[model samples]
Target: MFDISMAEWSQNAPARARLLLVGGLVALTGVLALVFSLREPGSIAIAEWWPAASAAVAAALCARKHERPYVAVGVVLLVFLGLLSGGRSLELSFLDSVGNAVEAWLVAAIIAARRQQLSLKTVADVGRLLVATVAGAAVAALCVATGAHLVGLDFAASFVPIAAAHALTIVCIVPLVIIPRLHFRVSTPPKTIAISGALVLSVLAAFYPGSPAPLTFLPVPILAWAALSQSMFTAVFQLIGVLGGISALTIFGGGPFAYVTGAVPGIAFLQLYSFTLAALALLIGAAAQERRVIERERLALASLVRGAFERGPNGFAVLQEAASNWFELIEINAAAPALVPDSFEHSAGQWRLQRASRLHEIISRLSAGTEQTFEWSAAPGAASTAQLTITVGHQPNGSRTVVLAITDLAPMREAQRKLEEQLARERAISNELRKLNQQKDDFVASVSHELRTPITSILGYAEDMRENHGVTADEESLEVIERNAMRLLAVVDDVLLISRRNSDTSEPPARRRIAVGRAIDQCVSDLGRFAASKSVEVHVKVAPDTYLYVPESDFARVLSNLVTNAIKFSVPGATVKITADTKGDEVMLEVEDSGRGISREDRDRIFDPFYRSPQAIRDGIPGTGLGLPISRDLVHSMGGSIGLKSVLGEGTCVEVRIPLVRPEATQ
Candidate 1:
């Protein structure tokens, strides 16, 4: 348990302690052995007073694992020298020494195995030690009994004394050695001294030589006094001292134990008395120690709670109920008095008058053991307001007291008012912006419609001039007029579409389950002539069974715009690929082309209405810039998304995903 080794034994501080302990145990064992061996025949031997054995057991219990072998060796050698000095045969001495060492080791092992249970400050630990002591000593006694029988001595007599002595020794000394050491001072030194003196005197008077009186009860009350008033260590020490003295006196033909007819019976009576006294003292001392610990903890917790209450930010006042349903202020924290108005006690101001009436209602709720809260101010235009919370606390004697807490509400109210004003201003600005946006959309829609009619009329008139007027020389001019008119018409149509989509009153186009493969075929067929004119190839790859839930005309317009843009941007002989496939629950459509792609700076805002790329304007590439925006809006209305991936000078791929019509929905 101590994590010690033979190397650490000499180098560590505990090693020195162990050496001193072993020396003391050896010296005590030597003296006791000498006294017992030199005893005269037919005299009391006091075999139940083996203090050295208990001390050896305590040392073994406390020793580190690696240090135990050295301790055991010391014990065996000490016992052997003492037995050999007392004139015992070499073989008998060796056997007896081995038995004692084994007993100490066995008892130590048993107690250490249950170390957590053995605080040695409780009656339960004392009882456990008694059991272990009896078990170990019984085994040692069997060894001694066998040795005596082999040597032609009385085996039964040797066995009883051996067992009784070891058991009694352990019961007396082990607790004193193993209990937690304390540096406690007696509260009343004079009273402690008097009780200690009384105990010593009683032990002497009770065990007087040849007294024929049963005065043994005299020391019982004195022992109890020491156990209850003194520390456990002091009480246990006194117990051992009294028991040792009584045993010594009885062995020398004195005390009530000496009056017994037989030596064995007298030794047994002394053993019983010692064990009873030891158990009583240990139980009382342990109970006292446990109670002291609980009381100290309680006082510490109370102090902490009081400290927090006094230092907290909120104002607090404790009120106790008085006669006739009235209440009186009993206690207050540091902040409480400042929060209370001077007029509240005088009952003069309107605030104080209102509080007086409110206190009556608060007291009623508090008496009913319910918590209540309310706000109050000094007057109608008071600069500050406070909220009071009242809670009931029950006392140990069943009387109820109420605690009132006050909190300032001025900062919270001001924050709420400012937040409301900010929200109102935001709402007004938002409404004005909405109205301006609506007017812009209306103007674009009306102007686009007017321009579309004139543009169509110009294209028709240019066709008639080239065909009917036979203008052979102005043919190129007529063709230019028709081309410009067509481009203007396309721009006007795109603006009209965007405005219609932006209008709140515009209804969504009706949807149908259109075959996506057929739609792609129709879009490519319409773009075939334009692709040929630009010398760009158009590739269509579509799944025949793929269907989409969208308006057919809108889908055609979105596909046409995408294809036309790809053809316009691509170099001559470059391929424009249109592909559509079903993926999961959606239909994926892609239009890819090897073209001069848009730059990253232009791509971000390319979807904005009328936002033509600078490159397109510089290169004379035609685009209304509303193509992607209108495409995105139309796709969104039909529950789809559109995005593009482009690398400048490499190519661009515009991908669109639209929800596929399910068979269950079609049914």
Candidate 2:
């Protein structure tokens, strides 16, 4: 009933515009008729044809233009009135003029004398204006009737039909001609009943002297009241109005006197009609309102119920609370039913049952109540059996509901178990490798110790024989023995250091603040002959006051390695420069040699344990592979970082950075 479909443009807007134009033209025509009457040519008393013609023309125009053609027809009625005074040849009678003026006056008075202000733009809103117009016409007729009576003219019931005829003309014209045009936002139905009742009352009111029937419009003011109460839907309520106006008229209506004046002349019908229309509008509006609310609430509940049931991902079912043993199934959304595997529900009465999916088993987990769940298991030959978790919520209607959520955990759980096993295996292998490494270190240390004893004894005997027998111990022979012994000692030392670090039981190296300048000076002093033999100048740059707290022996070993490397790599005429200084909280030592330097690949892994460069091996550089590793270890024991930078065939630089913790005295 509350349909918005009527809002289509073909239905109401064009009609409203036509009605607005028609009403304006009709009123204009009426005024023109009056003006013609007042003009020359027998002072308009003879211009009877023009008045009628003008009305006819205006009505035709309004009929085409308006949805309701009453306003245009009213203009025509005013023009037609000229017939009474003999076509205005003589001065038109003042009585007829007064009656016409009063009709117009009353319509304006209803608008102006309104107790509440209104902005009438909708069909329901304009319906009240139609009522007022009819009632005003009635008042004019009643007044004419009363004035005739006071002058001793006999009044007749015949006046009633004339008023009705006039009113009917308005209704027919307005509906046929106007309502399809002037555009408004709201849709409004044609006002047939309201106009009819008002027209009947208007003719009844206007002709009688001092007629109260004009007051029929008193009820129409209630339209203003609905301004707030029925804003958008006011048109619907206006289409439907208070029905029993004729009955009310008959009850209080007895004669022309009773009819022309109000039904309860002074206080009765006026108040009753107004309150009744208002109360009735409120009542009918409330009914429409109530129906709308109920529809909305019902739709909402239905949607919520559907969402809960249909959107479930897993299997679900219902069972009767009364019969627990004979479980019968009713409806299911799942592919498989797991709960009622061995059982089915009774197909009778209000209590019904349903099934669960392949992975589910109905487990009675409810303690006191008759609620339960089903566990899901893997079904064979399926991609994977859906594992399920189920819960039941009790319905107030005494139906038990089961909800199942299926989850597959096979792949995830298996992967996690494998990861744990892998970790265990790795720990076992690490333990075995550690034991083997310790044994290897011990064996190397033992062999080196025994070999060193024999070599030392041989060397001492050879030295004695060379001195006593006056045999020449040539430089090459002496150098060979010395270099071999040193190489063996280096290998022995590397093995011992690795084993000690692995056990973590070795004593930490002694630490003391030693001046950076003094340490570099001592290394250069010791390496002077070595550098001199290679014809490589060893230059020293020392920051005199610089110092670092590190083991003196470890520092000496580190510096000795750097100088020996520089001398070994330097070209005969080139220089090897050693520099030392304090930088922030650390002391930096650098050794740079100008010669064919280490290659990129060798430079990267140069300090790796037992690593020897291809160039050094090919050149028969006599040294153990432990020199760089041992130097790095000694430097690290004193908390320092050892680094190298080199370019092929250009030069190499070795740097040791140590924390500077100056002591009160230095060795």
Candidate 3:
């Protein structure tokens, strides 16, 4: 099935116009042939018979190469058909129609093949088109000379005129049709009207009667103006108009070429005139078009670069190198003025007078083609120490410029000053704290010493009274006094030891290897009476051969304090477990009591000096609240750690880990 839509699109306005142009050209050729035959008396002939056909084919071919072959063939066939139908009774033969089609095809093919070469921008391009026209016309003239010979006409005479005529026709017509289609440009209506008027007036003046023979050259200047002021399309159209005017004048024996006596030579001279004018118009017009395109591109690129330079955040400046290694400021963007106060000066001068010596060295390096970047500080007497990052860039023309980025360092300097003041205040407060701490240690040592002498006397007297006398009515009272006196002495000793530990001049504890099992056994034995008074069961689990690298007296005190606290807190019949075990490189001792445990709120403060749990105070447990804290200090001095874990109403556990002694090292 045929698609009617295809036919519809092919017959659109542009397509229809092309068809009309081709058909009209073919009809015009036939009509001009008949008219020329009447002008020549006795024989019917065609003047430049195939010019319109050649132009139609060339126009179609130049539209676009991919469609050229199809368009050229279609137009050529249509023109041939039109010629045959119109010239049936005009002495036009079938061979003539065939020859015209062949000539059109030859010219179109040569032009299409060398289309790029015929850009008319250079003299070479115009020369190539002229050569192609002459070659194609020579081939077609052979057919015309053969036909003239068969008809017994002058073949030699007819060949030159026919060839020249065909060449001239194509030079004037093809560019008019093809250049306009290829390089179409929209021109102002007023400009088009003005150019058209000028063209008409020039053609009339060049060909009008009684004008000098050299006056025909006047149209050459008009054609040159059209090529320069208008597009290639407009220029080619004006050339065709001038050609028409010259041809009409020559045929009437009115123009310079028409003054020749013989018809063929006169027509040949006319053809040459038209060919020369057409070449000039086409070549100049093409060069003008190329120049316009280049100028437009240059302007667009300049605009783009200027916009980028203006909107950039960083300052930019260009300097031109001058005599004696000096520089002249050529250009600077908007941001450059704020960076350098006198940046807008056009004269050559040393703009770096305000810059530092270091900045001058950087500029010297840049002039030697070495790029450099460094921080610069402004000279004194400026508002502030302007810290600037200066970068030096070198150009290819031995010129250099320095770009400065200023940073205000005043806020940073202010913050640093405040920090220094804060540090000084803290140092003063720290010294005062040290002095107070020293005084406090001295007071504690003095008080413990003062209280210790009396406590020792009282303890000695109480021991003597209990040991020398027999059981009496006041025996229990004596026992009570002795027990409390010993406790008070232990408290005093703890205070003295803690004070010594805090003092700078205090001596370190003397470390010795002692059996861990024996130490724990002695602690349990020492706390046996206290456990009996409370009716608490003391359980001892000591790992045999376990030893500790610590002071014997200090270890004994730590064990005694833990065991005493465990027995005091435990209820009657509750077990107080004292376990000593070796764990890796450490000896761990635990004092666990199944007693009223510490509350969560009091656990953190359990080892603090003079701090006791609420349960101990409520139960009237006799304690100075110094046992655990003193034990912690002693353990830490021996390079050990002490910790407590307790659950309310469940039990309390105290664990102490001390570094174990190697028997071999001790030996």
Best by TM-score: 1
| C-alpha RMSD by candidate, in order | 9.4, 16.9, 16.8
lDDT of candidate 1 over 569-651, digit per residue (tens): 99999999999999999999999999999899988997887789898899998887888888888787677889999999999
In Å, residue 608's CA in model 3 sits off its true spot by 54
Give each model's whole-structure lDDT: 0.75, 0.53, 0.68
Colliding pairs, model 3: none
TM-score for all models, in order of appearance: 0.64, 0.41, 0.47
* Ten contiguous residues minimizing lDDT sum, candidate 3: 1-10
Query: Of the candidates numbered 1 and 2, which has the greater TM-score value?
Result: 1
Order of candidate numbers by lDDT, starting with the best: 1, 3, 2
RMSD of 1: 9.4
475-568: candidate 3 lDDT, tens digit per residue: 8998798788888888888888889988999877788888988888887887777778889988888888888778899889888898888888
The 10-residue segment with the lowest total lDDT in model 1: 1-10
Q: Give the TM-score of candidate 3.
A: 0.47
